[model samples]
Target: MTDYQKQSPMQAIEVNNIKKSYENKYALGQPDSKEGISFSVSQGELFGIIGPDGAGKTSLFRILTTLILPDSGTASVDGLDIIKDYKEIRNRVGYMPGKFSLYPDLSVEENLKFFASVFQTTIQENYYLIKDIYQQIEPFKDRKAGALSGGMKQKLALSCALIHKPSVLFLDEPTTGVDPVSRKEFWEMLKRLKNQGITILVSTPYMDEARLCDRIALIKEGKFIGIDTPENITAGFNKTLWSVQSNKMFKLLTDLRSHPFIDSCFAFGETHHITLKNNDLTINNLCRWLQQKGHEEIIIQEIKASIEDCYMQLAQNG
Candidate 1:
């Protein structure tokens, strides 16, 4: 076949219309954990699955990492079928679950050595791959895995996952419980790994983390609401949003929700973000209405869109 006709070996991860569900007893009156989900991650790309709790990020990661099977549809890792090549795929992928799943009683060094042994390799053989991460925790090598702090545990878990030298690394909410400094450190480690050409797929509920990935898929209610570069996703927001604040935030929020011109409004940090039904709404009109309602020290200003804003908009529409 000619070069144009030949299939390109680009995608390191491929998920196509996958679906999974549990019995009602397990579901708790919710939809399936995964619903017709589909996406791909290019070779060496750091792809992110951005979603909140119970958004099916874990379920999808389980399927891709060969720990569970999808009820329908298909997925592949390193171009190998998830089902047919489950064994081979297991050897080719590294997965750090959302929760710390390492042996609690084991020391840091033991945990790393155990995982490497299970993969038929030794820490000495692949020590270079995890050297940067392992070195940080090496001083505490004798500490039991369960006794470590959140950030230390995170690094240890990541180190264990990479011991196998897998081509694609799947991290499910790796930074969920870590402190701000540790979260920042964890992403820096990911960036270094990415530079080494390891394909990384991470999922997180924190919208701020989405910007760190090369591309992100915003998942909600067991489906993708948006998928693109962080910048592009923020740019795709079509409405004019404003930051609103007042001396009485609670009262201001209630009043804003009651306004007929408000399209969507939600508390964002110290301020509330609201979009109008149309761009024709004027700040003066809102200020006048709020003033009449006894609101004081009202502050309203148009603001640039953020990933959080985009996710909120999608959740509202879908």
Candidate 2:
């Protein structure tokens, strides 16, 4: 690890009471979106913003990246005000938007050259910076960016982002729409980048990816519900979780929700995740009650809580 990675309390990004809004019909064209969103990232940390579509992830990224100004509140990147230091921030940060923004007609090498030139740097100057990621797609440097596979395109885009050797990297759902294997590869690349002492702030909708980050903030409706490491967040879910499956899933959901002893029930994979209203409720009792309710082929087992489970719990409580 580098000296930068050894710093104990360095903050690379700080956002305070950020607010933004769009026109609202009810308010007679007044702003009507985003309010009081706040979060921060530590230096050399891989922080993740986990949320679904329309959860204000893009708006937050835009504000932090200096692409769009927030209606109110202050955000600083690398200890510089985003508004006053917009130019400096732009030069010191690499932004990989959710969609591929490189020229489709440009070949892999052409795109890299374009970005490098825009930053007033040569590929050789920063070749060592992005060599690990660039080498993966260098063999296809002659191919058009649009002709590359999704995984290859992702790698190329990342290489372009790092061409300038930025201190912070903002990735807005970089893994979305990619295959699972590609997603894994992308994360491995991020880990390598973090190892190089780059502060990475990535947003993703996949709950499973939350576990890979050093810490994650769960966002909903432009607000943060929880922020912690994956293990801590899962550990804080005080409710006992049970996986229940019956012959009829729909009926099982309905019955489970209506059960007096059930606190919450959500469909999780092959089974319904059920939380008890109280610790007094036991698996045998639940099975007997389900059987009495004419639910056959019932299977209930206690299971460890996952980040998804914790997220669902928070969403439900809110």
Candidate 3:
């Protein structure tokens, strides 16, 4: 329900009970990736896996991209079994890992050609697919990939990934270290790709980017705590929330959490977001208490729970 209509009855991707761990250091979950990791992505839907680092986003992506096998699970990409049809799956999907994996010594144009050839295709054959992105770096065709700026490198990697015109695209933390402008431009490109009927699965650590997806899965500690549209996720919050700020911002958080009427409190940028335990006290009363604690410049404003606030609450309860 990403607001994007399904173009096909067959799912672009399907996962069931996918689980993995490294020497038990990073298990997806106790059993079945915490009651089993299962989800389906409709064709042409732009789904996002939003979480911080070490949340198993990369592990999940690697399994789907055929870069590695899951310890236990069943998955299909483009209707091809991840295990039985992995070879064909590789041919039908494009993967861009968190790090730049392109050949460092090769030129930007050369890299694109090489990836296209691996799929037994040619850049010219699918030039229309990546024309907009490639044109931005076309002038740097001869520049070595390793020598290009981070933004340019990102564009090159993306162009190469799309050169084969795969049915699905997997991007893992694609904007992790890129500049803000590049990140913005990259998302615009993804929107365009989605409009062209490509199903995109992207993961990002930026909470603010959750709104860009048709739907998002909030993963924490290797498990998905919540999955839904950004609006719905926040709307599901049942508690009363407020944003409180004071001159002593750090101390304000500590004081707010210790209050009996405050159910939960967490620092959100310049303000401390809190949910009330009950209607025992009003905002004016809370401000007075803060003033008693030697706080100045008090500002308390009721606000809606954001995705981060929702994530915090869900992670705590999950």
**Which is the leading candidate under TM-score?**
3
RMSD of model 1, in Å?
3.7
Scanning candidate 3 in windows of ten residues, the lowest lDDT window is 1-10
Task: Give the alpha carbon lDDT tens digit for every residue of 66-138 in model 1.
Answer: 8888877888999999999999999999999999999989999999989999999999998899999999999
CA displacement after TM-score superposition, residue 42 of candidate 3 (Å): 0.4
RMSD list, candidates in order: 3.7, 3.9, 2.1
Q: Candidate 2 has which clashing residue pairs, if any?
A: none
Model 1 stretches astray by more than 4 angstroms: 1-9, 24-35
- Over 4 Å off, model 2: 1-8, 25-35
Task: Estimate TM-scores for all models.
Answer: 0.94, 0.92, 0.95
lDDT of 2 by residue, 102-150 (tens): 9999999999999999999999999998888889899999999999998
The 0-to-1 C-alpha lDDT of every candidate, in the order given, reads: 0.90, 0.89, 0.90
Clashes in predicted model 3:
1
Give the local distance difference test score of model 2: 0.89
